[model samples]
Structures are given as structure tokens and as C-alpha cells.
Target chain A: MKIRTCKYFAKQSVKSIWRNKVMSLASIGSVMAALLVIGIFLILVLNVDYLAAKLESQVEIKVHLVDGLSDTIIGEIRKEIKGLSGVKDCVFVSKDKALKDFSESLGENSYLLEGLEGDNPLSDSFVVTLEDPRLAPQVTLAIKAMSNIENVVYGKEELEKLLDVTYFLRVGSLVIVAILLLISVFIISNTIKLTVYARRREIGIMKYIGATDWFVRGPFFLEGVLLGLIGSIISIGLLATGYYYIARYVEQQMFGLLVISLMPFQEVLKSLTVSLLAFGVVIGSLGSMISIRKFLKV
Target chain B: MIELVNVSKTFSDGHKALKNINIKIDNGEFVFLVGPSGAGKSTLIKLLLKEIDPDQGNIIINGKDVTKLKRREIPYLRRNIGVVFQDFRLLQEKTVYENVAFAMEVVEASPKEIRRQVPIILSLVGLSKKSNLYPSQLSGGEQQRVSLARAIVNGPSILIADEPTGNLDPDTAWEVMKSLNEINHRGTTVLMATHAKDIVDAMRKRVIAIENGTIARDDKKGGYGI
Candidate 1:
């Protein structure tokens, strides 16, 4: 590009938007709406994933030792559980300790079991927390096969359901976001197409006077980019301001109850601003090119 | 200078437009391409502008083979040539100044150049007082004049007007023709295609008449004679 001419065309593009005020405004409005939807969804997805991951990290599995388990055999099980890939922490709970836990869990029935814990009716067990809950089932099954492990209790159904939900959340969010992004692109492009249709005569005149493809296209494409950039900025601002009240309310209402942290302002800001700006500029230009291409053939 | 050598064009529906046509126009000459309807005049002009390509032939402009010019380079070639269509072709949304300034902007003229050149060109087309007027606010003659100003403002080495007077009254048509003649006198090669007998005869410039897409007559100082 001849820098001066490129700048001139850039300025003209900006002017064209103002000159065709109604259409330009419509285009900007549609793009902003599209990007806003996308930006909000992106932030929501990121926060949900963060929260699910935090909760998943705290769940654990219990492995019961076999009847008549030897001290050396118990040591071996500890070494084996500790060596398991995702095992974050492993501790052997003695049979007496297990009985005490059972009794305590019984509440009013604890009195009925008061003398039983000394007899150690409960078998020894290992408390195992894995780095990832999704991997817990496979590792727990392996521990159940060990010589000293008689039974395993990790709420298998519950763990599976939690992992399935996380997988679904991650996959479903991505698919929905992808579909919405495609919709956003279509909306942005169609809006630009309408603007181009309105300016068809101007394009013909421009070509008749010797403007090259890029020259003729520069202003419209720049208009697309400018619209996109501005739309992104607008959406980011709205999202940031809106989410502030939402996060504040959520934090206050569920202060001590929430198992996961509320989304931070910075993370939301990053997702909102980055995605919208990218959506605006890239989609805007592509839309402009598709719209203007038919006329530019002249 | 523009030259066509054995250029032929056939539409996809199998309609032949230009057939083995050959013509040469020197720099600074004002010439009319005259013919009846279906005589290939508009097709020939479209070919020259690279809006349509010849199926079998070469087009040389300033000694370069325009047929071989890249798709992107077609508009660059246009910069050295100005075209005024029969439709007036003024950008309806912009003021007269904006419409005229658009030409320079597409080619990326500096703000300084735009500021200096646009007013002069608009004035040359008798539109100085109406710089802020849109095409909707102007008469048919005035709109065509704006298109003229836009075409010529860059001072192209060649100017092409394809039936510029097609929709004007005699007086307005004469005014548009007069603008073309003045630009021609300034040494820009002028190639105009018209079926208007009165305007053609009145100008008394070299005339190339076509029949069935081939040049039938090339008259020095011709007067709309077939």
C-alpha cells in the first residue's frame, strides 16, 4: 500500500460510515449484539469450567483392607496406593479408627457401638484422594484387585456422574459457543451485505474512475474492521459493567455456601474484551469482502 | 495509446459481441465510436475497460498487453483512464465534492492533494457552487457533470465516455459533449461511443464506425457517416 493513499482510503472509509449514517449504525448495532452474546458465553464457559475443576479436586475414594490384613501387607498397600498415578494423598486408617468413624457417622446409634470399636469390627481402610476425580474409577478398580484390598467405597455412581457432567459441560459449552459464533458471523456478514447493496452505485462509479479492487474494497473492509473494533469495545464495556453487579450479588448470596470461587473481574474482562474484539474485526472484514465481491467484478 | 488486435468476445449464452476487431487510438485524440443498436459499441467499450475480456485477441494499452494484466491490476490500468457511463454513475449518497473526492480517495491521494484538486475539478465541470449538493439535489445534466468531474479529476491520460449524453436533452447533452471536447483539447486521449447523430456530426472528430462487431469505417474528420 502507498501509505498516504492507504491512510486516505482509511479516512474515507471512516467518513463513508458517517455519510451513510443509518446503514452504518445498523451494521454496528448488529455486530455489537452478536459479539456481546459471544463474549458473555465465553466468560460463562470459562468460569463454569474453573468452578467444576475446583470441586472435582476435593472428592476422594476409600479402599478397605482385607480380613486379617498383616502390618507388612498394609505397608505394601500404602506403597502401592502412593505409587498410583493420580494419588495426591494416601493414609492408612486403622481398623479401630474405622470403627470409631462408623460409630460417629451413626449419630444416636453411636451408643450402641460404643464398646464395638475396641473389638475393631471394622476392617482397615485407606483414604485416597486423586489429582483428578475423572481418573478415580480406573485407579480404584485396580486397587480393588490388590491382594489386601477386600472392598472399595468411593461412591462410584456419584463419581461417574460428576465426571460425566464435567465432560458434558466442557463439550456442550464448546459446541454451543461454536454454533453461536457461526451465527454471529452470519449476522455480521449479512448486515455488511445490506450496507454494500445500498452503496452499489458508489462502487460502480468508483471503478469507472480507475479505483483498483483493493482500493475500492479498502474503505468497506476498513469500515467492517472499524465497526468490529468499535462493536467489540462497546460489548466489552457493557459486559464488564453488567457482570460486576451479577458477580457481586452471587458472591454475597452464596458467600460461605459456594464450593468454588466466584469469577474474578480480571478473568471476565479478559474473555469479554479479547473474544469480542477478535469477533468484530475478523468477522467484519470477511463479511465486507463477501458482500462487495459481486459488484467489484465490474 | 490503445490498440486492439483481432479481439473477439462471445457471451456464455453464445451471443457474439465483438468479432475480430482491430483499432488503434493515439494519445491526445478525441474520437467517437459510432454504430447502430447491436453494433458492439458498448461491448467494445466494456472490453477496453476490462469489465469483459476478449475470448481471442490481445489488448495493448500504452504498449503493455492489457489482456495479460492480472485481475488486481485491472483497476490500476483504469487509473490512467477515466470512464463516464451512460447512467451518470454519480454516488447518490455523497455530496458533489464527496463524489468527486471519491475518485482521488480510491487511488489514495493525499489529504493535501484532495483539498487542492477536488475543488478545481468540480469547478471545471461547472459544479463549484454546488459542491455540497447530492446527486438527488442535482439535475440530470448536473449529475452527469459530477460523474464527468470524478472521471477527469485525476487527469487520466485517456478518458472514455460510453454514451455520456444518452439521457440528456439537446442543450445539456451539448454541454456534456463540450466538457469532453475541452478535456480532449487538454491532450488526454478521448474515446467516446455514441449513437447520437447530432452530437457526432457536430464534433467533426475522427470516427470509427462498427458493424457486426468489426470496424466498418475509420474516417479522419468524420461526421456520423456510416
Candidate 2:
């Protein structure tokens, strides 16, 4: 294709789109609405995943030691736990320090532990954090077989349910996004079908005049792309504006109220713009290509 | 030159449009295809343009078998042939000059080439003065001339006009026919399908009359036969 020919195609596309302004606008609006919904859904899913990950990182296992364990045996137990694959960090809490912290937590009830100072009932413990909290059960079972290790405790059911929710969200959002994409393509193609129908006679004339299939199809393809690009840019602008306001509210009003952190506007903005632009172009071009196929048989 | 050796076509509904058509049109010859409606005149034109394939034969244009040409090669085949219709199918949105230039553009002619050739073709068809006028703004005859200019702007070796003057009055039809004659004189082979009895009798060109899906008569210098 010559540069002049491309210019001609672009000119023809713009002219046709302008002529069918109502139809073009309808397609653009469809694209915009579809993208907006997808974008919002995407933001929600990503934020949920982020919060789930944050909560996952905070879960830890408390390993309590057996009574009368020698100091060297407790040291050896800490070393063995540290060598586990998913262990992030290990901190040993001596019984004396544990008793002191327990008393502090009990506040005015510290007097209840005064008579038991000589024989502290609290077991010396190890606070174990993991790289992936989902591995808590396996790591807990492994630590239970260690010498002087009495028991391993973690919120088992809570972690399992959290992982299940995360898995469902990722897969479910993907299915929903795929369906939304199909709907967007359908709307766009139908709109382009009308444009093609209106100019069907012109297409027939062009075909008879020795216009190649590409020459006949070039303008329609460009028309679809233009519509997609315009719709994407508008939707991105609307989404960004909405997200910015929401992010501001999260920071100013909901910071202390919600434990889950909202992803910053700038973090989501880049990927959202890029993905939607690609999506719009794909939807628009695919729609036109499918709509114009039967007419080109001439 | 164009040749059709035993070309036959049957529509999907079992209507035989053209049966064993055999035509040999030499380069630079002006031939008329004459018949009533459904007489296979349009079918013959479509076959020559490679619009539809023959159910059983070969169509050769410029020594190449068009039936065997690949799907992608059809455009180049059509580029060698220009076509016009009864409706004077000029792009209504374009002016006379742009309409002619559009044909050249379709062939991907260079911008400089389009600029150089469009004016010459417009002048040849006597549409030079109306170059800036839209199709709706022109008289019926003027519009037909614009279509004629468009047909030849790409310098196709063969010009096929299917009822080019069907919608025009006698005088206006004759005006378009004069332009076609002039184009034929300039060394381009012209094949026109028509039903105008007086124009056929007056032109006295090589006439091939078709009826019932076959050629009924072929004459070197024929008139419209009763």
C-alpha cells in the first residue's frame, strides 16, 4: 500500500464515519460502556488480590516448646525450623520474656502471675513467619516431628478459605471479562454492518471497477479502528477520573477504618490504559473484518 | 484479445445463464452484445470480467486462462478490464475529476500519475469543464460520460459496458455511444451489451446477438436483426 493510498483510505473512512454519525456514535458508546465495566471489574479484582496477599503475609505459626527443654535443644529447634523451605524468619521468645509480655497484655492483672514467677507456666515459643501462608499446614506438620517441639498453631480454616476466595476471584473475573469482550465485539460488528449495508452499492461499483479486496475493505477497517481508539480513550479518561476520586477518598477517610490497602491510582492507570487501548483496537478491527466478509464476495 | 472456449454457467437455482459460449474478440475491435433481458448478455459480460466462474470451460484474456487464476490474482485480471453500467454508477459523493481519479487510485497509481492522467481522461470524455461538479449536479449524459472517463482512466485494455445507455434518452444515449466509439478508435477493445435496436442498426459494428443462452447470430458489420 502506497502512502497516498493509506491517506485516501483514512480520508474515506473519516468521511463515511461522519456521514453515519448516529451509527458511529452508537458503536462508540457501546465500546465505552463495555470498557468502563471491564475496567472497574479489573480494578476490584486486583485490589482484592492485593488485600488477600497482605493478609496472607501476616499469618504466622506459633511453635511452643516442651517443658524442661535444655537451652541448647531449644537453640537446635530454632535452627531446624529456619532451614525449612518456606520459612521467612524465625524469632525465639524465651519463657521469661513470654511471661513478661503476657503480664503486660493482662494489664492490672499482672499480680496473678506474681506467685508463679519461680515456675513460669508459659512455654518458650518460636514465632514463625512464612513466605506463603498457604503452606502453613505442611510446615506445621514438619515442625511437629522436631525434638522438644510440643505443638504448632495457626488459623488453619481461615487461611484455607482465604486461598479459596482468591482462586475463585481470579478465575471468575477472567470468565466475566471474556464475556464482556465478546459482547463489545458483537455490538461493534453490528454497528459496522449497518455502515457496510448503507454503502453496499458503492462497494459493488468498486469491485466492478477493479478495486482489490483490500482496497474495498481498507476504509471499513480504518473506520472500525478509529471508533475503537476513540472509545478506549474516552473510557480511560472516565475511569481514571473516577479512580482518582476514589483513591483520594480511601486515603483521606477510610485509611484507619479498612485494614485492606487500596492500590494507588498511578499503579493501576498505566496497565488499564494500555490493555483497554489494545482491547478497543482488537474489538473494532475484528468487528469490521467479520461484518465486511460477505459483501466482498462481489 | 479475449477468448471463451466452450464456457457454460448454471445458476444455483438450475437456470442456465450461458451455455457453451464461444467468443473471440480481437484487440482494438468494437463489438456489441445484443439480446433481450435474461438472454445471457449480462452473464457473458460477467464471465469475461471473471465475476462468476464457468461451470465447465475456460476464459482466456490476453493469453492467460482467467478460470485458473488464483483468488488473489482476480484483482489484476479485473484491472485489465474496466466496467460501466446502466445507472452510470459514479460515486455520488465525488466530483467528476475525483470519480475518474478514484479508478486510478484503486489500481494504486502514483499520486503524480493520477494527477497527470485524470485531466487527460476527463478531457477525452468532454467532462473537463464539469470536473468539479458532483454526479447529482450533472445531466444524465454528462454523468454517463463521467462514468466512461472513470472506466478508461486506468487505461484498461478492454472496456465492458453492460447497458451503459439503458437509462438515457435517445440523444443522450447517442452522446454516450459517441464517447464509446471514440474510446474504441483509440485502440481499446470495447464490448458493450445493449438492447437499443436503433443504436445497433446505426453503429453497424461487429454484433453478436444472443438468445436462449446461446449466440443466435454473428456478423462482421451487422445491424439489429429482426
Give all candidate RMSDs, comma-separated.
5.3, 4.3
TM-score of chain A of 1: 0.67
Q: Which is the leading candidate under DockQ?
A: 2
Q: Can you write out model 1's per-residue Cα lDDT over B1-226, one digit (the tens) per residue?
A: 9999999999998888889998989999999999898889989888888878899999999988988989878877888889888888776777999988888877778879999999988777788999998899988888888888888888889999988999988989988887888788889999999989988898889999998878899998999985
Lowest lDDT block of 10, candidate 2 chain A: A289-298
Per-residue alpha-carbon lDDT of candidate 2 for residues B39-120, written as tens digits (9 for 90 to 100): 9998888888877889998999999999998877888888889888888888888889988988888788898999999999
TM-score for chain A of every candidate model?
A: 0.67, 0.73
lDDT of 2 at A51: 68
Segments in model 1 whose C-alpha atoms lie over 4 Å from true places: A1-161, A222-259, A262-265, A280-286, A294-298, B12-15, B120-143
Q: On residues A1-298, what C-alpha lDDT tens digit does candidate 1 reach at each position?
A: 7887667667867777777677667667777777777776677667766665655666688888778878888888899889989889998888887777777767677798866645767777889998878888888888887886788877566545656766776677677666655655565556566656766777777777777677667766787788778777888898899898888988888775545566798878877777778878886787677766744455
lDDT of 2 by residue, A1-298 (tens): 6898899889988987898888889888988987898788778777766766777778899999898888888888889999999999999998999999878867788898887789888988999999988888899999998877788898676656777876787788788778877877777777778778888877877887777888888998898898888898999999999999988988998775466678878878987898889989998998788787744554
Cα-lDDT of candidate 2:
0.87
